[model samples]
Target: MKKDVRGMLKDFTDGLAAISETNKANVNAFMRLLNTGYKEGALSTKTKELMSVAIGVYNRCEYCIVYHVYKSLEAGATREEIMEAAMVAVGFGGGPSMAYSATLLKDSIDEFENDFK
Candidate 1:
């Protein structure tokens, strides 16, 4: 994996974050809402992990993709569930991003394959 994602993203991600922080409170509010939802059981941890994987893939966030795959596995999601999340992601992001997300999750996916049964 590449050590630096700041380049591929061209600081675009950071710029978006910066813009969000300056423009309004939406980003933090959304994060707080999600946190509350997760803590209140309105959103299950597994579902959140799957959603994270989807977002990571769609956004072409390689590190996030890999981390979330492991997170889903740790949260007790099945292999099929993880793959389905990936499918849903690629459905939005197209082939290149899908391929990248899969590559990002490869080792962890292999490590957790048996847990999916």
Candidate 2:
């Protein structure tokens, strides 16, 4: 992988923090929305995280893919479950999504899957 998945996560975290320093209102709103979205609802948190993984892949958002993959595992999704979600994205998103699923998503799993165990 061109970028280490863990490093990408760290960088994203740092970047978010820096942005939050200046863009506090928007950042706080975004964080609230994120927390609300990820909170358990009709769907379990694990299911939500899996859905996020698929959405991230479909959108080709590298940082989102890394974050949600890690969160999915943390929420107790198995590697297989994560992959299945990514495949669902590929179905909708076609080759562009597949490319991310095959590359960045796979790398994110490799880098973070064991961390949950």
Candidate 3:
């Protein structure tokens, strides 16, 4: 079935918050790690988010795809740049990554691209 990228993001956000209530310490640490990882460092946040998109596709994680696509856009990654990252994943992940890149990734881009504008 086709996934609702926006709804997936909302659910993920809500779920993360709920999970944090039950597992505060670990969740907080993970959140901190994410914050630190995404900060502008050796690479720009946009580059990191793009790399995340490729990793998500290669790993076939739906939530990761949606989340990182939204972040990639928020970090100022163009659709072309996102696609290029996904293609690099396809190079390593083969058919599976291509499938996701064409479907879920495309759908995510369609759903969230305008939100950043």
The candidate scoring highest on lDDT is 3
Ten contiguous residues minimizing lDDT sum, candidate 2 = 1-10
Tens digit per residue, CA lDDT, model 1, 1-117: 533332423454565588786765887786678667556277789999889888888887766776677668878888778888888888888997667656765555775556555
Instruction: Please identify which of the two predictions, 1 or 3, would achieve the higher lDDT against the true structure.
Output: 3
Better of 1 and 3 by TM-score: 3
TM-score of every prediction relative to native = 0.61, 0.96, 0.98
Give per-residue CA lDDT, model 2, range 48-117, as digits (tens): 9999999999999999999999999999999999999999999999999999998999999998988988
Q: Score candidate 2 by TM-score against the native.
A: 0.96
Q: Which stretches in model 1 have alpha-carbon errors above 4 Å?
A: 1-37, 112-117
lDDT of each: 0.70, 0.94, 0.96
TM-score of 1: 0.61
